[model samples]
Target: MAEKPTLRWGILATGMISSWFVADLSLDRQDAQANHVIQAIGSSSLEKGKAFVAEHLPGKSPTVYGSYEELYADPEVDIIYIGTPHSFHKQNCLDAIRHGKNVLCEKAFALTAPEACEVLDAAREKGVFIMEAMWTRFFPIVRALQQKLHEEKAIGAVHRAFCDFSFDMKIPSLGPASRLKNPALGAGTLLDIGIYSLTWTILGLEPPLGPAPARAAPEKTPKVVAAQSLDDGVDVATTIVLLYEDGRQGIATAHATVKSQRDFARIEGSEGTVIVEGDAAAVPSSFIVKKLDGEEKRYDFPRPGRGFYWEADAVALDIAAGRKENAIMPWAETLRVMEIMDETRRQGGARFPVDKD
Candidate 1:
């Protein structure tokens, strides 16, 4: 029998997302072949960390730490998963990388493009693996969509696309200011949900065209087209437009107050359209493809392990292979998404405390 690749994981934070991840990891363990294991959990308080472990992980006993620094220093831990809020991602990730530990950070990867770049640079210098935990990109449905777009050209020429995600958090009524509405925590609809809407755009559009034709004609460098943001101060809602060189346009919108039934996405082209129904952020259950020829195809994707094991599998495969990151959610792609979000915030006037002109 081949030896199982052992991946010792240390979790930072004990929030809702962290609980979900731990639950998924435990569920994966039922399969004897699973390679990942939780070794420790660190929270701001030792008692809280212990309670998290006791409540979430019943049988398996994992170490609990009062501070993240101790988790970073633990020799037994091979990788650390950061579940901290968006604003803390930069510092937490940097500290983990500096300690020579691989990291899997939850999205939005960081508060700003510059902060994300700093983490990328540190990962490169330290030779440590780091990845944004954009689990959707690792799912079977998303993979299938990518292949369909590239191989079948299901939506020929990719003329335009629209995606939306919204839910009513009822922030003002929820007293105590949940992180969802707290500006200090980098909370808003854009960074929280807009990132998912933007994923479709990124997947469809190729990189921007080189310098504009006119500027190059004079043998001078062209001015870079900076991204535009909504500038609302707090992004309760946001709309982003992405333009491609081939005349393709992508529209993504998100809101915290409204309830969008499908959390849908549609891609239109010269030949046909592809409609994905269900929360794109979650593992989608079904999709439909309609051709110009009046033919229709429907697809139903099976849910596996609460829709998180696929990402866990990707992490295990990459780590065991000694790879620095998953190609599916490459560091470059993550940086691009952050850049877009930063610009969106700037346009929306959604400024975090750390964002200085």
Candidate 2:
């Protein structure tokens, strides 16, 4: 057997998400498909970058930079991870792509579908690997359940699915400038948590694996109906209903004011139902398959580090294989989900700073 490929990562932000991702990469998982090395950390200030490295990585001695451009220009970096706010994703991705860098950008890929298109188009032109970091889709639990439901036809013909991601964010206590309350930063339940809910619904309804079926025309895409509750011009809660052409329905929801149940999602089929439960929709760990014939099966996954390594491992393998996009979370899927949120926000009246641009 040969050694796994190594991918040097340049982390572009020192936020909470970046810390979690780096921690996962630092773990010593024997089953990892590839080796991940933290080559550098980029921050607004040199001191901040150094602090992040010291705090999150401890003894690791990765290079720290005061600016993003330096990290992008570093030849040692095989890829750049963008953990910036939603509003900054488009520009951040474009800048990295311009530098000929592969990218793993966090979800809510952009503030709008067109912005997402611009970034993806740049990556395609650059001929580099680029994917939205919707890490949930890469989880072992999600993969197993998806295969069981779609590939094996475990639940028979699927008809409807519902998913929700909600938490008591204590929005009232947050200042106007806080990312959770500031419209300028793209603060909203839809983009933040609702995207996960929408992702689960899509997973339950669409078969991502197996041989490609005949491409459905644009008109075949589900019709989106949505509603939102606003607090001081920011959406605090949102609900979306996707009506498919064949009469199948997918319901997705998110909220900032209340917590959701452990069983946050369900996929109903002709013979059985799949009940998904997780600490959060974004970090699903287990699920149960209950059939009409009285057969029940359950599955759980080991989560050593918030489950970020699954996506990172997949990304490294893709880069090593010279693929320009991920098969599981492909650019088309990212754009489709972004468009769904775009329409959802449009109908929900949740406007961010990017709308004016």
Best by TM-score: 2
Clashing pairs in 2: none
Per residue, candidate 1 scores C-alpha lDDT tens digits across 51-86 of 998899998899999999999999999999999999
Per-residue lDDT of candidate 2, residues 1-357 (tens digit): 977999999999999999999999999997999999999999999998999998999989999999999999999998999999898999999999999999999988998999999999999999999999999988988879888988899999999999999999888999987878898888999989999999899889877643224433323569999999999889999999999988889999999989999999999999999999999899887899999999998887767878899999999988898888887888888898999998998899999877852
Give the candidate number with the greatest lDDT.
2
Error of 2 at 334 (Å): 0.5
State the weakest 10-residue window (summed lDDT) of model 2.
210-219
Task: List the candidates' TM-scores in order.
Answer: 0.89, 0.96
TM-score of 1: 0.89
User: What ranges in model 1 sit over 4 Å off?
Assistant: 1-4, 29-34, 175-177, 206-232
